[model samples]
Target: MSVPALNRAPDAVTTRVTAPGSRRRPDIEGLRAVAALLIAVYHIWFGTVSGGVDVFLLLTGFLITGSLVRAMERDGRVDLAAFWTKLVKRLFPAGAVVLGAVLLMAYAYFPRSQWTTVIDDVWAAALYYGNWHLALGSVDYMAENSAASPVQHFWSLAVQGQFYLLWPLLVCGAALLAVRLGRSARRGAAVAVGTVFAVSFGYSLWITATAPVWAYFDTGARLWELALGGLLALFVHRVDLPGWARTVAGWAGLAALVLCGLVIGDSLPYPGYASLWPTLAALLIILAGAGTAANGRLSANRLLGARPLTWLGGHAYTLFLWHWPVLVLHLELTGLERPTPGGGLLVLGVSFAAALATSWMVDGGVSRATRRLRTPAWSLAAGVLFVVPVLVAGSLWAQSIERDRQLRTELSSNPLAYPGAAVHLDQDLARNLPSLPVYPDTTTVARDTIDQTRACNALIDQTEVVTCEFGDPRSDYTIALVGSSHVRHWFQALETLADQHGWRLVTMTKNACQFSSGEQRYRGEVFTECAQWNDGVMAALDELEPDTVFTLASLTSVRSGPEEHVPEGFVERWRQLDARGIDVVAVRDTPRFSFRVPDCTDRNHRSECSEPASHSMAERAPYLELDDVPANTRFLDMTGYLCQDDVCHGVIGNQLVYYDTNHFSYSFSQSLAAVMEPYLLEAAGRAPEAELTLAEAALSPEEAAEAAREHDGSS
Candidate 1:
């Protein structure tokens, strides 16, 4: 094998006599084939190749850097503009082709609603900000059942681009220092390479221990592989090896990489200590081809140096670009995972065909067409123009997805309606938490719960001050609504009745706040806010004993574990309220889902969203019971509003009862006025006391009509 004789070209190069000592290496191409195949297998079956992509990254850094270093040494100086020009020629055409194809697929197969998100992703990929955007989106690439994201493969490209930006200056600096320091040029280069390897390896080790994801994504932590190659390039000419040794090392290196997918598989943690195996394997192969394999017949035997593999190698960059987007879009459209065994094989076949064809058109056709233009600036501009729109479109699409999501949140303030609602909503009690989407903001404006305490002596014509005031004290009974967001939903119905009954409703509930006195983690901290607020409410109740205490107790026992029935330490808490001469009654919580059932919208799939039947509610009795409470505490189950016959449907009375997976809509609750009045009377011990019919207390035609009008206007 022989290297091409040193020569300079302003913009174009003519063929020169081959150097006597230089050679072309077949083992390097075989190694590349092995890396690509491993990455493909891992993305396909995953059980076969786990950390194989890191091997490819290491090889990319090594091979590309090795070529640049050799050119720089011969030229005696680095040409920044020329270097960048060559890179743009090498990378952009294939990337642009893949991006354009992805956009076309998005238009055909994706829902119109997803267009915004996909557009933003396109723009991000074009700008090389895809990895940062993914990080902010909290995307986990290693998850088992993720939706097919088009730019997930770009994280590796981002890492590579970071290296490309920094490596040339480092290499040129090392070359210049060698000339200036009066040291052997090769030795100076070795020192620079050694420094990079030592520092990068150390950083890699540190990040692997503390931040493996960052380590895997960052270029700095991965520079050691390229450094190892650069160092090898300078010193390999000095070593002498027997033919058997060369063959064994070369074959062994190739075999190690080929068998890597089978040995390591996809379950490995990735780019951590485990990556050293393949990186070292790639290193060995590159080193084996250093001295005797330039370009001669003996150096490049036909079997190892076949034109097919070489041509594939030539289109490797383009093939890599096309394969992932093809596989991703195929999966997105089919949702078949891969055509497993038969299906997977078919998908692989189609993917390979598309990749090769696109590679030929984009890499070969585009490169050849652009090569004769002669002007570096114009060629570079053409490449940038092709790549930029696709990238901008991807970025814009992602932003649009976010915007659509925001609009959804604004339309329905229900926590469950918005994907990231939990993080954005404020939970304070003074803010009209009774409204739909506005659950009880538990933290009172009067931060000290005791300061907000008051009595309802003005409206209630009763002996005991059972009601406690919190927000406004001007209304009739000064009724205090207590419990969690579940309790707050009832306030919409309660507020209507409260106004009619001349009772001022005071909300004292928080999201997930149980009546039972217990400590629980909320918003990443142990929250005693609910319990503390409850204590303050009870104290206020003692001070402002109104006509009666209207409290909504959540059905907490259903979600309890076998060993932990009700929340511990909270059972005695409610009893203390009862002992203080205040009535403590609980309304069971509505059912929550393990998955989102969006068809439960007000009118969509109404039949399927009907309340549960009588029989199904009875079957769920074990989960519905309030058996853990003291006898003095009364339990009111509102399950009837959400149940019909034997099954619980997602809606009631032409309204989306459960605004989210759980929690009733205000409109739905108003419709349940008839259902709730009887239960409220029974729980308040007034149904039998007054011997009144449930219909008398329920909402009549006039009230229902007015409420319906209000809902219509709001909607």
Candidate 2:
């Protein structure tokens, strides 16, 4: 959303003046309206980049910088205090109202599991750092599937607010320097702003190429768009384009703006050279209005300054704030990933009504009431007084959720009460159900499956193999755990066996990087790091000469439905390890869900929170064929423990089964240690050949018959 940079002084001249080099341009207001509408439509229905935000950034630079320069020219000094006072009074009221509304809705409608995230987003948006928060989230693989925050649109507003705070200081400094040098203030400011544009644009191109996700929200990468507007402000007045030339340029720019969304999808890296299209288009439209009559022949201004468009433009800031949250809430409530046509229309209608009312009641009303507070200190105090409580409340809400989550984890740590998956299969299903208040509450689930706290898992971007050892380091029997997070999550189960058997356990894992010879893709980029890390892992394994290697056998292809198979490259790695006399134990991958399991269980009963085993399982026929692998290689399937009777429940044996959609909860994995120990020992050729103990022996025929009769009668 763009900050409305139109002059807001009650006594200022109407923005419709057509005088030569006039301060007001009605076309800019219409451009703001157009940009706001484009962004709303793209977000709600098209799901593409409209380049509307770039248009807003350019407009913000042109309008705000132009106003400051004119003030310096007329008064011989910029009124920084008055400028900030007016800006704050104009912007903060509407933003604060929206933030408060979003917080209320989050508490009332969203699941408590998401409360901490919502509160943190609110805090970030309120303090104008929401963009950075989102930028960090984009890079974190763990946060990849998180639902979009309702206030995510606030990132653009944060960028604008940051610029509002910094741009004026730069302009004032440049003006002062110009006065000392006997040069025009506007020219000196242009030179300074131009340098910022050039440097920032260069950085934007490089960063967008290397790290597009971060570049999308980075202020430094975005500064060039605003700087382009500032440069236009400085020079537009000096341009003497002929009427024909202005008309041609205006239409060309308008055509480009209208087609931007269709031509440039969100899949393309943004704010790089691609951003120049919209910013340059906006500049053309603004320049075309310089000398045109309101209804002149071939005039872009006449078309842009129409009554309906200007009305929408006047309320653009409020529209930008209200539309996104409404759209997000609509999707959540209706359970539609994309809006239906009827729902889309309803969202737009509601957003328009809200924007219209808020623009008048909060934005316009606050500005008028606060106009009497002429001193900057008084204005600052009023703004702080209005905003600080909301910020504090948001921060406190996040802290409170964290505290409650920590308390739950502490209270639920009873080993006897929560023996996890360690209990006998029959006893677990019959008596040792999941505990109350669930282990790994929503606030902790994201981190609950992680073994990196012990420094066993490699960082996502690192190619070097980092090993963390557990159990007896000097043990002759060595078992190396290798591959991606899927392999690492199993370490919690294996650690117990390693200790009991006096085996040295070595873990080498990289985030989401499987040990396959095939190419890997992470966040849509070719993952060269995975390939490099695999090379290091092979060398390390060769040197260590581990007796056994444990890793994932198959991965389910989400896009291909229930299909699962070993990647060709995985077979290559397995053969290499087999040649080195390292026996391989490949465990079947766990069933994955489309939604977060803890969240599902929190919202629904255990019986209601299950998926069909048939759908969740990879096509098993291929895995069964792996029986013909090298003599040293063995495959294990433990799906029966995770799923029963063609259905897989999210919670098993009174314990949460997964920390997220796929990874096992640490406690649940620990529980599985008992079930896994025998297989691991067998794989290592160390299973004891002793007669079974009474408790461990299979039931005799008469006893089994009696148990079956009892179960039938109970059912």
lDDT top scorer: 2
lDDT for each residue of candidate 1 in 1-715, tens digit (9 for 90 to 100): 1222111111011122111125545545544555666666667665344444655565555444455556656766666666566556556666677777778787777644235445656666666667666554432211111234676677666666666677767767776787788765456666777898899888878866554545566666767766665665556666545555556665676667767767766445445566777777766655555555342333322334566765555444545565676677666656555646765566567767776786677546876677676455865775687787776666565566456545543654553332111111122211222223221111111111112222222111111223433434575445556655556566656665555545566665544555556665543455555546556666766766643455544342323322213444445656776676656555555665332222233223344444333312234443245556665566666553354234455533333455444555544554454456555556555567453565454444344334433533445
| For model 2, the run of ten residues with the poorest summed lDDT | 9-18
* Model 1 residue 550 CA deviation in Å: 18
Segments in model 1 whose C-alpha atoms lie over 4 Å from true places: 1-21, 47-49, 139-146, 184-186, 213-215, 238-240, 293-304, 392-715
In TM-score terms, which candidate is top?
A: 2
TM-score for each prediction?
A: 0.61, 0.89
Encode model 2's per-residue lDDT on 28-116: one tens digit a residue.
Answer: 77877888899899889987889898888887787777767777777777666766765666667778778888888888877666776
CA lDDT of each candidate?
A: 0.52, 0.75
Native-referenced Cα lDDT, model 1: 0.52
Error of 1 at 240 (Å): 4.6
Model 2: clashing residue pairs?
A: 421-671, 433-653, 433-654, 434-653, 434-654, 434-655, 435-654
